[model samples]
Target: MKLLQIDSSITAPNSVSRVITAAVVERLRQTHPGLQVIERDIIGAALDHITPVNFPSSHPISALAGDAPEFAAGRATSDAILDEFLAADIVVIGAPMYNFGVPSQLKAWIDRVIVPGKTFSYGPEGVKGLIPGKRVIIAISRGNLYGSDQPTAALEHVETYLRSVFSFVGITNLQFIVAEGVQLGPDARQAALDKALQETSVLKAA
Candidate 1:
Protein backbone atom coordinates (compact mmCIF):
# COMPACT_ATOMS: atom_id res chain seq x y z
CA MET A 1 0.00 0.00 0.00
CA LYS A 2 1.04 3.59 -0.64
CA LEU A 3 0.46 6.54 1.70
CA LEU A 4 0.57 10.11 0.57
CA GLN A 5 1.40 12.56 3.38
CA ILE A 6 0.47 16.03 2.24
CA ASP A 7 1.67 18.77 4.58
CA SER A 8 0.10 22.16 4.03
CA SER A 9 1.43 23.80 7.16
CA ILE A 10 3.65 26.83 6.66
CA THR A 11 5.44 26.05 9.90
CA ALA A 12 8.18 23.50 9.41
CA PRO A 13 9.19 21.66 12.58
CA ASN A 14 6.96 23.71 14.85
CA SER A 15 3.66 22.88 13.19
CA VAL A 16 1.37 21.15 15.66
CA SER A 17 -0.75 19.43 13.04
CA ARG A 18 2.34 18.27 11.19
CA VAL A 19 3.73 16.70 14.35
CA ILE A 20 0.45 14.87 15.00
CA THR A 21 0.20 13.78 11.39
CA ALA A 22 3.75 12.46 11.50
CA ALA A 23 2.87 10.44 14.56
CA VAL A 24 -0.16 9.05 12.78
CA VAL A 25 1.94 8.08 9.80
CA GLU A 26 4.53 6.49 12.03
CA ARG A 27 1.92 4.46 13.91
CA LEU A 28 0.48 3.24 10.63
CA ARG A 29 3.97 2.33 9.48
CA GLN A 30 4.42 0.16 12.55
CA THR A 31 1.44 -1.93 11.48
CA HIS A 32 1.82 -1.68 7.71
CA PRO A 33 5.54 -1.94 7.24
CA GLY A 34 5.15 -2.45 3.53
CA LEU A 35 3.43 0.85 3.06
CA GLN A 36 5.37 3.24 0.82
CA VAL A 37 4.95 6.84 1.90
CA ILE A 38 4.98 9.84 -0.43
CA GLU A 39 5.39 13.28 1.07
CA ARG A 40 4.33 16.56 -0.57
CA ASP A 41 4.78 19.93 1.18
CA ILE A 42 2.69 22.50 -0.68
CA ILE A 43 4.44 25.32 1.16
CA GLY A 44 7.60 24.51 -0.74
CA ALA A 45 5.95 24.37 -4.14
CA ALA A 46 2.57 25.97 -4.15
CA LEU A 47 0.01 24.68 -6.65
CA ASP A 48 -0.97 27.10 -9.37
CA HIS A 49 -4.63 27.89 -9.42
CA ILE A 50 -6.68 26.97 -12.44
CA THR A 51 -7.34 30.29 -14.12
CA PRO A 52 -7.32 31.89 -17.56
CA VAL A 53 -3.54 31.71 -17.51
CA ASN A 54 -3.27 28.19 -16.12
CA PHE A 55 -6.40 26.54 -17.51
CA PRO A 56 -6.47 27.58 -21.11
CA SER A 57 -7.48 24.13 -22.28
CA SER A 58 -10.65 24.43 -20.24
CA HIS A 59 -11.63 27.36 -22.42
CA PRO A 60 -11.65 25.36 -25.64
CA ILE A 61 -15.44 25.17 -25.53
CA SER A 62 -15.70 28.95 -25.11
CA ALA A 63 -16.36 31.20 -28.08
CA LEU A 64 -13.35 33.40 -27.27
CA ALA A 65 -9.85 32.40 -28.29
CA GLY A 66 -7.36 31.31 -25.61
CA ASP A 67 -3.60 31.11 -25.27
CA ALA A 68 -2.51 27.77 -26.71
CA PRO A 69 1.13 27.84 -25.58
CA GLU A 70 0.35 28.91 -22.04
CA PHE A 71 -2.22 26.15 -21.72
CA ALA A 72 0.17 23.57 -23.11
CA ALA A 73 2.85 24.54 -20.61
CA GLY A 74 0.68 23.82 -17.60
CA ARG A 75 -0.52 20.45 -18.86
CA ALA A 76 2.53 18.51 -17.74
CA THR A 77 2.46 19.87 -14.18
CA SER A 78 -1.26 19.27 -13.93
CA ASP A 79 -0.94 15.71 -15.24
CA ALA A 80 1.91 14.88 -12.85
CA ILE A 81 0.02 16.22 -9.85
CA LEU A 82 -3.11 14.28 -10.81
CA ASP A 83 -1.16 11.09 -11.34
CA GLU A 84 0.48 11.30 -7.89
CA PHE A 85 -2.86 11.80 -6.19
CA LEU A 86 -4.55 8.97 -8.12
CA ALA A 87 -1.70 6.55 -7.45
CA ALA A 88 -1.89 6.90 -3.69
CA ASP A 89 -3.89 4.24 -1.85
CA ILE A 90 -4.30 6.41 1.22
CA VAL A 91 -4.06 10.18 1.58
CA VAL A 92 -3.16 11.97 4.82
CA ILE A 93 -3.58 15.73 4.89
CA GLY A 94 -2.08 18.09 7.47
CA ALA A 95 -4.19 21.24 7.37
CA PRO A 96 -3.65 24.09 9.82
CA MET A 97 -6.53 26.52 9.69
CA TYR A 98 -5.60 30.03 8.63
CA ASN A 99 -8.16 32.72 9.47
CA PHE A 100 -10.76 29.99 10.19
CA GLY A 101 -10.22 28.40 6.79
CA VAL A 102 -7.74 26.17 5.02
CA PRO A 103 -4.35 27.49 4.15
CA SER A 104 -3.93 28.74 0.58
CA GLN A 105 -1.39 26.02 -0.17
CA LEU A 106 -3.81 23.21 0.61
CA LYS A 107 -6.54 24.79 -1.45
CA ALA A 108 -4.15 25.13 -4.38
CA TRP A 109 -3.27 21.46 -4.19
CA ILE A 110 -6.95 20.55 -4.15
CA ASP A 111 -7.59 22.66 -7.20
CA ARG A 112 -4.96 20.72 -9.14
CA VAL A 113 -5.93 17.22 -8.04
CA ILE A 114 -9.71 17.49 -8.35
CA VAL A 115 -9.81 18.02 -12.08
CA PRO A 116 -12.75 17.15 -14.27
CA GLY A 117 -12.64 13.88 -16.28
CA LYS A 118 -9.68 12.78 -14.14
CA THR A 119 -10.99 12.62 -10.58
CA PHE A 120 -14.65 12.75 -11.65
CA SER A 121 -16.80 12.22 -14.70
CA TYR A 122 -19.78 14.17 -15.95
CA GLY A 123 -22.50 12.13 -17.59
CA PRO A 124 -26.22 12.38 -18.18
CA GLU A 125 -26.68 10.90 -14.72
CA GLY A 126 -24.72 13.79 -13.24
CA VAL A 127 -21.25 13.41 -11.64
CA LYS A 128 -19.48 10.14 -10.91
CA GLY A 129 -16.32 9.89 -8.86
CA LEU A 130 -13.48 8.18 -10.70
CA ILE A 131 -11.12 7.71 -7.78
CA PRO A 132 -12.94 5.46 -5.35
CA GLY A 133 -11.91 2.95 -2.68
CA LYS A 134 -9.45 5.30 -1.04
CA ARG A 135 -9.25 6.23 2.63
CA VAL A 136 -8.27 9.79 3.64
CA ILE A 137 -7.31 11.32 6.99
CA ILE A 138 -7.14 15.04 7.64
CA ALA A 139 -5.18 16.42 10.60
CA ILE A 140 -6.58 19.85 11.36
CA SER A 141 -5.29 22.37 13.89
CA ARG A 142 -7.12 25.53 14.84
CA GLY A 143 -6.47 28.47 17.14
CA ASN A 144 -9.94 28.53 18.73
CA LEU A 145 -12.36 25.74 19.58
CA TYR A 146 -14.57 25.67 16.54
CA GLY A 147 -16.58 22.51 16.24
CA SER A 148 -20.14 21.57 15.35
CA ASP A 149 -21.24 23.06 18.68
CA GLN A 150 -19.02 25.59 20.37
CA PRO A 151 -19.64 29.18 21.44
CA THR A 152 -16.46 30.48 19.76
CA ALA A 153 -16.54 27.86 17.07
CA ALA A 154 -16.01 29.72 13.87
CA LEU A 155 -17.15 28.36 10.50
CA GLU A 156 -15.48 25.04 9.70
CA HIS A 157 -15.05 25.68 6.01
CA VAL A 158 -11.73 23.83 5.81
CA GLU A 159 -12.88 20.41 6.94
CA THR A 160 -16.30 20.73 5.34
CA TYR A 161 -14.86 21.81 2.01
CA LEU A 162 -12.36 18.94 2.08
CA ARG A 163 -15.09 16.42 2.84
CA SER A 164 -17.36 17.71 0.11
CA VAL A 165 -14.68 17.93 -2.56
CA PHE A 166 -13.04 14.60 -1.74
CA SER A 167 -16.46 12.97 -1.62
CA PHE A 168 -17.14 14.39 -5.03
CA VAL A 169 -14.02 12.52 -6.18
CA GLY A 170 -15.36 9.28 -4.56
CA ILE A 171 -13.32 9.39 -1.35
CA THR A 172 -16.11 8.72 1.11
CA ASN A 173 -14.05 7.10 3.86
CA LEU A 174 -12.67 10.31 5.27
CA GLN A 175 -11.58 10.87 8.85
CA PHE A 176 -10.49 14.00 10.71
CA ILE A 177 -8.49 14.63 13.89
CA VAL A 178 -8.94 18.25 14.85
CA ALA A 179 -6.78 19.88 17.55
CA GLU A 180 -8.77 22.92 18.47
CA GLY A 181 -8.11 25.55 21.15
CA VAL A 182 -4.44 25.39 20.38
CA GLN A 183 -4.03 29.11 20.80
CA LEU A 184 -6.03 29.21 23.99
CA GLY A 185 -3.08 28.36 26.24
CA PRO A 186 -0.39 25.77 26.79
CA ASP A 187 -2.73 23.56 28.81
CA ALA A 188 -5.51 23.85 26.31
CA ARG A 189 -3.16 23.20 23.42
CA GLN A 190 -1.79 20.07 25.06
CA ALA A 191 -5.26 18.83 25.89
CA ALA A 192 -6.54 19.31 22.39
CA LEU A 193 -3.44 17.65 20.97
CA ASP A 194 -3.87 14.72 23.32
CA LYS A 195 -7.42 14.29 22.15
CA ALA A 196 -6.33 14.38 18.54
CA LEU A 197 -3.61 11.85 19.23
CA GLN A 198 -6.08 9.54 20.92
CA GLU A 199 -8.32 9.73 17.88
CA THR A 200 -5.35 8.91 15.68
CA SER A 201 -4.76 5.84 17.80
CA VAL A 202 -8.33 4.74 17.16
CA LEU A 203 -7.92 5.34 13.45
CA LYS A 204 -4.75 3.27 13.41
CA ALA A 205 -6.55 0.39 15.07
CA ALA A 206 -9.20 0.53 12.38
Candidate 2:
Protein backbone atom coordinates (compact mmCIF):
# COMPACT_ATOMS: atom_id res chain seq x y z
CA MET A 1 0.00 0.00 0.00
CA LYS A 2 1.10 3.55 -0.70
CA LEU A 3 -0.08 6.71 1.01
CA LEU A 4 0.46 10.35 0.12
CA GLN A 5 0.10 12.90 2.91
CA ILE A 6 -0.34 16.56 2.10
CA ASP A 7 -0.34 19.04 4.95
CA SER A 8 -1.35 22.65 4.24
CA SER A 9 -1.59 24.16 7.68
CA ILE A 10 0.32 27.39 8.19
CA THR A 11 0.26 26.82 11.93
CA ALA A 12 3.30 25.02 13.23
CA PRO A 13 3.32 22.47 16.05
CA ASN A 14 -0.30 23.18 17.00
CA SER A 15 -2.43 22.58 13.93
CA VAL A 16 -5.57 20.63 14.75
CA SER A 17 -5.92 19.21 11.26
CA ARG A 18 -2.29 18.15 11.28
CA VAL A 19 -2.76 16.28 14.53
CA ILE A 20 -5.75 14.40 13.15
CA THR A 21 -3.93 13.71 9.90
CA ALA A 22 -0.98 12.29 11.81
CA ALA A 23 -3.27 10.11 13.87
CA VAL A 24 -4.90 8.77 10.71
CA VAL A 25 -1.49 8.04 9.20
CA GLU A 26 -0.36 6.32 12.39
CA ARG A 27 -3.45 4.17 12.44
CA LEU A 28 -2.96 3.21 8.80
CA ARG A 29 0.72 2.54 9.35
CA GLN A 30 -0.07 0.22 12.21
CA THR A 31 -2.53 -1.68 10.08
CA HIS A 32 -0.25 -1.79 7.05
CA PRO A 33 3.27 -1.84 8.35
CA GLY A 34 4.74 -2.27 4.88
CA LEU A 35 2.92 0.69 3.39
CA GLN A 36 4.96 3.36 1.68
CA VAL A 37 4.23 6.85 2.97
CA ILE A 38 5.01 10.05 1.10
CA GLU A 39 4.58 13.37 2.87
CA ARG A 40 4.37 16.77 1.11
CA ASP A 41 4.22 19.90 3.21
CA ILE A 42 2.48 22.42 0.97
CA ILE A 43 3.26 25.30 3.28
CA GLY A 44 6.93 24.64 2.82
CA ALA A 45 6.82 25.08 -0.97
CA ALA A 46 3.67 26.68 -2.31
CA LEU A 47 2.68 26.77 -5.99
CA ASP A 48 3.27 29.81 -8.10
CA HIS A 49 0.36 31.86 -9.35
CA ILE A 50 -0.52 32.28 -13.05
CA THR A 51 1.56 35.39 -13.40
CA PRO A 52 2.53 36.93 -16.70
CA VAL A 53 6.03 35.48 -16.32
CA ASN A 54 4.72 31.97 -15.66
CA PHE A 55 1.42 31.88 -17.55
CA PRO A 56 2.87 30.31 -20.67
CA SER A 57 4.83 27.78 -18.68
CA SER A 58 1.71 26.09 -17.33
CA HIS A 59 0.52 25.27 -20.81
CA PRO A 60 1.58 21.84 -21.99
CA ILE A 61 2.55 23.12 -25.43
CA SER A 62 4.79 25.87 -24.12
CA ALA A 63 8.03 26.39 -25.99
CA LEU A 64 10.25 26.57 -22.92
CA ALA A 65 12.19 23.45 -22.06
CA GLY A 66 12.14 21.84 -18.65
CA ASP A 67 15.54 23.42 -17.87
CA ALA A 68 14.44 26.92 -18.74
CA PRO A 69 14.17 29.91 -16.33
CA GLU A 70 13.44 29.15 -12.70
CA PHE A 71 10.59 31.56 -11.93
CA ALA A 72 8.48 30.36 -14.87
CA ALA A 73 9.43 26.73 -14.58
CA GLY A 74 6.22 24.68 -14.63
CA ARG A 75 6.84 21.35 -16.35
CA ALA A 76 9.03 19.96 -13.59
CA THR A 77 6.76 21.09 -10.78
CA SER A 78 3.63 19.88 -12.56
CA ASP A 79 5.23 16.56 -13.40
CA ALA A 80 6.37 16.00 -9.83
CA ILE A 81 2.93 16.73 -8.44
CA LEU A 82 1.24 14.57 -11.03
CA ASP A 83 3.60 11.70 -10.37
CA GLU A 84 2.92 11.85 -6.65
CA PHE A 85 -0.83 11.80 -7.21
CA LEU A 86 -0.54 8.92 -9.65
CA ALA A 87 1.69 6.84 -7.41
CA ALA A 88 -0.50 7.08 -4.32
CA ASP A 89 -3.13 4.52 -3.47
CA ILE A 90 -4.48 6.80 -0.80
CA VAL A 91 -4.14 10.56 -0.51
CA VAL A 92 -4.53 12.29 2.85
CA ILE A 93 -4.70 16.05 2.89
CA GLY A 94 -4.74 18.32 5.94
CA ALA A 95 -6.79 21.30 4.79
CA PRO A 96 -7.37 24.29 7.00
CA MET A 97 -10.43 26.23 5.88
CA TYR A 98 -9.72 29.94 5.71
CA ASN A 99 -12.43 32.54 5.04
CA PHE A 100 -15.00 29.88 4.16
CA GLY A 101 -12.61 28.22 1.69
CA VAL A 102 -9.30 26.45 1.52
CA PRO A 103 -5.96 28.14 2.08
CA SER A 104 -4.17 29.76 -0.85
CA GLN A 105 -1.39 27.22 -0.55
CA LEU A 106 -3.77 24.33 -0.99
CA LYS A 107 -5.44 26.00 -3.95
CA ALA A 108 -2.08 26.55 -5.58
CA TRP A 109 -1.16 22.93 -5.10
CA ILE A 110 -4.44 21.94 -6.67
CA ASP A 111 -3.72 24.10 -9.69
CA ARG A 112 -0.34 22.50 -10.12
CA VAL A 113 -1.60 18.93 -9.86
CA ILE A 114 -4.82 19.22 -11.86
CA VAL A 115 -3.53 19.17 -15.41
CA PRO A 116 -6.22 19.30 -18.10
CA GLY A 117 -5.29 16.30 -20.23
CA LYS A 118 -3.48 14.48 -17.45
CA THR A 119 -6.24 14.41 -14.87
CA PHE A 120 -9.24 15.09 -17.06
CA SER A 121 -10.21 15.52 -20.70
CA TYR A 122 -13.06 17.22 -22.43
CA GLY A 123 -13.90 15.30 -25.55
CA PRO A 124 -17.00 14.58 -27.57
CA GLU A 125 -18.32 12.70 -24.56
CA GLY A 126 -18.09 15.81 -22.47
CA VAL A 127 -15.73 15.48 -19.45
CA LYS A 128 -13.84 12.34 -18.64
CA GLY A 129 -11.81 11.33 -15.60
CA LEU A 130 -8.34 10.05 -16.35
CA ILE A 131 -7.10 9.21 -12.88
CA PRO A 132 -9.62 6.88 -11.35
CA GLY A 133 -9.93 4.46 -8.45
CA LYS A 134 -7.98 6.28 -5.76
CA ARG A 135 -8.99 6.86 -2.15
CA VAL A 136 -8.88 10.43 -0.88
CA ILE A 137 -9.30 11.75 2.64
CA ILE A 138 -9.35 15.43 3.47
CA ALA A 139 -8.78 16.41 7.10
CA ILE A 140 -10.38 19.82 7.31
CA SER A 141 -10.25 22.25 10.21
CA ARG A 142 -12.26 25.41 10.46
CA GLY A 143 -12.82 28.17 12.99
CA ASN A 144 -16.59 28.12 12.34
CA LEU A 145 -19.05 25.30 11.95
CA TYR A 146 -20.78 24.98 8.59
CA GLY A 147 -22.75 22.53 6.37
CA SER A 148 -26.07 22.43 8.19
CA ASP A 149 -29.05 24.68 7.80
CA GLN A 150 -28.47 27.38 10.34
CA PRO A 151 -27.37 30.98 10.63
CA THR A 152 -24.19 29.99 12.38
CA ALA A 153 -23.18 27.76 9.52
CA ALA A 154 -21.52 29.54 6.68
CA LEU A 155 -21.25 28.37 3.09
CA GLU A 156 -18.34 26.02 2.50
CA HIS A 157 -16.62 26.35 -0.83
CA VAL A 158 -13.49 24.46 0.15
CA GLU A 159 -14.91 20.98 0.57
CA THR A 160 -17.22 21.41 -2.39
CA TYR A 161 -14.41 22.57 -4.62
CA LEU A 162 -12.13 19.74 -3.58
CA ARG A 163 -14.83 17.16 -4.15
CA SER A 164 -15.54 18.55 -7.59
CA VAL A 165 -11.90 18.61 -8.58
CA PHE A 166 -11.12 15.12 -7.30
CA SER A 167 -14.28 13.71 -8.81
CA PHE A 168 -13.45 15.34 -12.10
CA VAL A 169 -10.19 13.39 -12.02
CA GLY A 170 -12.10 10.07 -11.62
CA ILE A 171 -11.56 9.54 -7.91
CA THR A 172 -15.00 8.59 -6.62
CA ASN A 173 -14.01 7.36 -3.18
CA LEU A 174 -13.68 10.47 -1.05
CA GLN A 175 -14.04 11.15 2.65
CA PHE A 176 -13.83 14.25 4.79
CA ILE A 177 -13.10 14.64 8.49
CA VAL A 178 -13.80 18.11 9.79
CA ALA A 179 -12.66 19.81 12.97
CA GLU A 180 -14.98 22.73 13.13
CA GLY A 181 -15.61 25.55 15.59
CA VAL A 182 -12.07 25.46 16.86
CA GLN A 183 -12.10 29.14 17.72
CA LEU A 184 -15.47 28.96 19.40
CA GLY A 185 -14.29 27.61 22.74
CA PRO A 186 -12.20 24.87 24.24
CA ASP A 187 -15.17 22.56 24.59
CA ALA A 188 -16.37 23.15 21.07
CA ARG A 189 -12.90 22.71 19.72
CA GLN A 190 -12.37 19.48 21.61
CA ALA A 191 -15.75 18.19 20.58
CA ALA A 192 -15.03 18.93 16.92
CA LEU A 193 -11.65 17.27 17.07
CA ASP A 194 -13.12 14.25 18.75
CA LYS A 195 -15.77 14.02 16.06
CA ALA A 196 -13.13 14.20 13.39
CA LEU A 197 -11.10 11.44 15.02
CA GLN A 198 -14.16 9.30 15.35
CA GLU A 199 -14.84 9.82 11.67
CA THR A 200 -11.30 8.81 10.92
CA SER A 201 -11.80 5.55 12.74
CA VAL A 202 -14.96 4.93 10.78
CA LEU A 203 -13.10 5.57 7.58
CA LYS A 204 -10.33 3.20 8.51
CA ALA A 205 -12.83 0.56 9.44
CA ALA A 206 -14.63 1.01 6.15
Candidate 3:
Protein backbone atom coordinates (compact mmCIF):
# COMPACT_ATOMS: atom_id res chain seq x y z
CA MET A 1 0.00 0.00 0.00
CA LYS A 2 1.13 3.54 -0.72
CA LEU A 3 0.13 6.66 1.15
CA LEU A 4 0.81 10.30 0.33
CA GLN A 5 0.82 12.61 3.32
CA ILE A 6 0.96 16.30 2.53
CA ASP A 7 1.01 19.25 4.88
CA SER A 8 0.68 22.73 3.41
CA SER A 9 0.39 24.80 6.56
CA ILE A 10 2.95 27.59 7.02
CA THR A 11 3.04 26.83 10.73
CA ALA A 12 4.41 23.37 11.43
CA PRO A 13 3.97 22.93 15.18
CA ASN A 14 1.12 25.37 15.69
CA SER A 15 -1.19 23.98 12.98
CA VAL A 16 -4.36 22.17 13.91
CA SER A 17 -4.73 20.72 10.41
CA ARG A 18 -1.25 19.25 10.73
CA VAL A 19 -2.19 17.64 14.04
CA ILE A 20 -5.26 16.02 12.52
CA THR A 21 -3.34 14.85 9.44
CA ALA A 22 -0.64 13.33 11.64
CA ALA A 23 -3.25 11.40 13.56
CA VAL A 24 -4.79 10.18 10.30
CA VAL A 25 -1.45 9.06 8.84
CA GLU A 26 -0.60 7.30 12.10
CA ARG A 27 -3.91 5.49 12.09
CA LEU A 28 -3.42 4.37 8.50
CA ARG A 29 0.14 3.29 9.15
CA GLN A 30 -1.03 1.24 12.09
CA THR A 31 -3.61 -0.47 9.92
CA HIS A 32 -1.41 -0.94 6.88
CA PRO A 33 1.83 -2.15 8.39
CA GLY A 34 3.55 -2.40 5.01
CA LEU A 35 2.42 0.98 3.79
CA GLN A 36 5.00 3.00 1.88
CA VAL A 37 4.49 6.62 2.83
CA ILE A 38 5.65 9.72 0.95
CA GLU A 39 5.60 12.93 2.90
CA ARG A 40 5.68 16.47 1.47
CA ASP A 41 5.57 19.89 3.11
CA ILE A 42 4.80 22.38 0.34
CA ILE A 43 5.44 25.36 2.55
CA GLY A 44 8.63 23.84 3.91
CA ALA A 45 10.01 23.07 0.46
CA ALA A 46 8.77 26.32 -1.04
CA LEU A 47 7.38 24.84 -4.27
CA ASP A 48 7.78 27.18 -7.19
CA HIS A 49 4.53 28.77 -8.25
CA ILE A 50 3.46 27.96 -11.81
CA THR A 51 3.60 30.74 -14.36
CA PRO A 52 2.92 30.92 -18.09
CA VAL A 53 6.58 31.65 -18.83
CA ASN A 54 7.87 28.56 -17.07
CA PHE A 55 5.01 26.18 -17.76
CA PRO A 56 6.26 22.88 -19.10
CA SER A 57 5.19 21.28 -22.36
CA SER A 58 1.42 21.18 -22.76
CA HIS A 59 1.79 18.32 -25.24
CA PRO A 60 1.67 14.64 -24.37
CA ILE A 61 4.25 13.26 -21.98
CA SER A 62 5.79 11.16 -24.78
CA ALA A 63 6.37 14.35 -26.75
CA LEU A 64 8.31 16.30 -24.13
CA ALA A 65 10.05 19.07 -26.02
CA GLY A 66 12.63 21.77 -25.29
CA ASP A 67 16.31 21.36 -24.38
CA ALA A 68 16.48 24.38 -22.10
CA PRO A 69 17.73 23.41 -18.65
CA GLU A 70 14.96 25.41 -17.01
CA PHE A 71 12.24 23.71 -19.05
CA ALA A 72 13.77 20.32 -18.43
CA ALA A 73 13.91 20.98 -14.71
CA GLY A 74 10.34 22.29 -14.68
CA ARG A 75 9.05 19.25 -16.57
CA ALA A 76 10.87 16.92 -14.21
CA THR A 77 9.39 18.65 -11.19
CA SER A 78 5.91 18.57 -12.67
CA ASP A 79 6.25 14.90 -13.49
CA ALA A 80 7.38 14.10 -9.95
CA ILE A 81 4.50 16.04 -8.44
CA LEU A 82 1.90 14.36 -10.64
CA ASP A 83 3.48 10.96 -10.15
CA GLU A 84 3.19 11.32 -6.38
CA PHE A 85 -0.54 11.96 -6.68
CA LEU A 86 -1.08 9.18 -9.19
CA ALA A 87 0.90 6.58 -7.24
CA ALA A 88 -0.81 7.13 -3.92
CA ASP A 89 -3.42 4.58 -2.91
CA ILE A 90 -4.46 6.94 -0.17
CA VAL A 91 -3.95 10.72 0.09
CA VAL A 92 -4.10 12.85 3.20
CA ILE A 93 -3.86 16.62 2.96
CA GLY A 94 -3.66 19.10 5.80
CA ALA A 95 -5.57 22.12 4.57
CA PRO A 96 -5.72 25.17 6.79
CA MET A 97 -8.12 27.93 5.86
CA TYR A 98 -6.37 31.13 4.85
CA ASN A 99 -8.65 34.05 4.08
CA PHE A 100 -11.56 31.70 3.36
CA GLY A 101 -9.48 29.65 0.89
CA VAL A 102 -6.57 27.26 0.71
CA PRO A 103 -3.04 28.61 1.12
CA SER A 104 -1.18 29.79 -1.99
CA GLN A 105 1.43 27.06 -1.62
CA LEU A 106 -1.21 24.34 -1.81
CA LYS A 107 -2.84 26.05 -4.76
CA ALA A 108 0.48 26.19 -6.57
CA TRP A 109 1.02 22.49 -6.09
CA ILE A 110 -2.47 21.84 -7.43
CA ASP A 111 -1.73 23.89 -10.49
CA ARG A 112 1.03 21.47 -11.40
CA VAL A 113 -0.55 18.13 -10.51
CA ILE A 114 -4.09 18.72 -11.78
CA VAL A 115 -3.22 19.60 -15.32
CA PRO A 116 -5.48 18.96 -18.33
CA GLY A 117 -3.52 16.17 -20.00
CA LYS A 118 -1.96 14.83 -16.81
CA THR A 119 -5.00 14.24 -14.57
CA PHE A 120 -7.86 14.74 -16.99
CA SER A 121 -8.60 14.69 -20.69
CA TYR A 122 -11.03 16.61 -22.83
CA GLY A 123 -13.21 14.89 -25.40
CA PRO A 124 -16.11 15.79 -27.62
CA GLU A 125 -18.43 14.39 -24.98
CA GLY A 126 -17.03 16.63 -22.23
CA VAL A 127 -14.24 16.79 -19.64
CA LYS A 128 -13.57 13.27 -18.43
CA GLY A 129 -11.73 12.51 -15.23
CA LEU A 130 -8.70 10.25 -15.51
CA ILE A 131 -8.41 9.13 -11.92
CA PRO A 132 -11.33 7.94 -9.86
CA GLY A 133 -12.09 5.99 -6.68
CA LYS A 134 -9.08 7.33 -4.81
CA ARG A 135 -9.63 7.54 -1.07
CA VAL A 136 -8.79 11.10 -0.06
CA ILE A 137 -8.87 12.33 3.51
CA ILE A 138 -8.71 16.04 4.13
CA ALA A 139 -7.79 17.55 7.47
CA ILE A 140 -9.10 21.08 7.64
CA SER A 141 -8.76 23.76 10.29
CA ARG A 142 -10.73 27.00 10.39
CA GLY A 143 -10.99 29.84 12.84
CA ASN A 144 -14.76 30.05 12.73
CA LEU A 145 -17.62 27.60 12.38
CA TYR A 146 -18.63 27.75 8.73
CA GLY A 147 -20.34 24.44 8.22
CA SER A 148 -23.25 23.90 5.87
CA ASP A 149 -25.72 25.02 8.55
CA GLN A 150 -23.62 27.88 9.84
CA PRO A 151 -24.51 31.46 8.94
CA THR A 152 -21.14 32.06 7.31
CA ALA A 153 -21.29 28.86 5.26
CA ALA A 154 -22.25 30.86 2.20
CA LEU A 155 -18.92 32.62 2.29
CA GLU A 156 -16.86 29.45 2.74
CA HIS A 157 -14.53 28.61 -0.17
CA VAL A 158 -11.89 26.38 1.35
CA GLU A 159 -13.70 23.06 1.54
CA THR A 160 -16.12 23.91 -1.22
CA TYR A 161 -13.36 24.74 -3.66
CA LEU A 162 -11.50 21.53 -2.84
CA ARG A 163 -14.61 19.46 -3.33
CA SER A 164 -15.22 20.97 -6.73
CA VAL A 165 -11.65 20.61 -7.89
CA PHE A 166 -11.22 17.00 -6.79
CA SER A 167 -14.62 15.99 -8.05
CA PHE A 168 -13.75 17.44 -11.40
CA VAL A 169 -10.82 15.03 -11.51
CA GLY A 170 -13.11 12.08 -10.52
CA ILE A 171 -12.17 11.73 -6.86
CA THR A 172 -15.52 10.85 -5.30
CA ASN A 173 -14.59 8.94 -2.17
CA LEU A 174 -13.63 12.08 -0.29
CA GLN A 175 -13.81 12.53 3.46
CA PHE A 176 -12.99 15.54 5.57
CA ILE A 177 -11.97 15.80 9.20
CA VAL A 178 -12.61 19.40 10.09
CA ALA A 179 -11.57 21.24 13.23
CA GLU A 180 -13.57 24.40 13.21
CA GLY A 181 -13.98 27.15 15.77
CA VAL A 182 -10.29 26.74 16.43
CA GLN A 183 -9.71 30.36 17.33
CA LEU A 184 -12.78 30.70 19.50
CA GLY A 185 -11.01 29.99 22.79
CA PRO A 186 -8.87 27.45 24.55
CA ASP A 187 -11.83 25.26 25.43
CA ALA A 188 -13.36 25.44 21.99
CA ARG A 189 -10.09 24.76 20.23
CA GLN A 190 -9.44 21.69 22.32
CA ALA A 191 -12.97 20.43 21.85
CA ALA A 192 -12.93 20.90 18.08
CA LEU A 193 -9.54 19.30 17.66
CA ASP A 194 -10.49 16.37 19.84
CA LYS A 195 -13.62 15.81 17.78
CA ALA A 196 -11.70 15.89 14.52
CA LEU A 197 -9.05 13.56 15.86
CA GLN A 198 -11.75 11.12 16.91
CA GLU A 199 -13.02 11.05 13.34
CA THR A 200 -9.53 10.29 12.05
CA SER A 201 -9.14 7.50 14.55
CA VAL A 202 -12.24 5.74 13.24
CA LEU A 203 -11.37 6.05 9.54
CA LYS A 204 -11.23 2.81 7.56
CA ALA A 205 -7.62 2.17 6.68
CA ALA A 206 -8.42 0.06 3.62
Best by TM-score: 3
* Model with the higher TM-score, candidate 1 or 3: 3
Kindly give the number of clashing pairs for every candidate.
Answer: 1, 0, 0
- How many steric clashes does model 2 contain? 0
Q: Could you give candidate 2's per-residue lDDT for residues 1-206 as a string of tens digits?
A: 89999999999687999998998898788767798999999888777764334433444644343435674456566657778987898899999888888888888778766766777888998999988878898899988878677575658877888999899899988888888889899999999999988877655622
**Using Cα atoms with residue i matched to residue i, what is each candidate's TM-score against the true structure?**
0.88, 0.88, 0.93
lDDT of 3 by residue, 1-206 (tens): 88999899988789999999999999998899999999999988867887653344553542444456557677677668888898998999999999999999999888776778767889999998888968889999999999999999987888999998888888988998999999999999999999999998888866
Candidate 3 displacement at residue 123 in angstroms: 0.9
Regions more than 4 Å wrong, model 3 = 53-67
Q: Which lDDT value does model 1 have at 98?
A: 91
* Predictions in order: lDDT: 0.81, 0.80, 0.85
lDDT of 2 at 9: 94
* Candidate 1 per-residue lDDT over residues 105-163, each given as its tens digit: 78877877776777888899999998888889899999887887887555767888888
Please give the distance, in angstroms, between residue 81's alpha carbon in candidate 2 and its true position after superposition.
1.4
Name model 2 segments beyond 4 Å from true: 50-74, 152-154
| Alpha-carbon shift of residue 70 in model 2 (angstroms) | 4.4
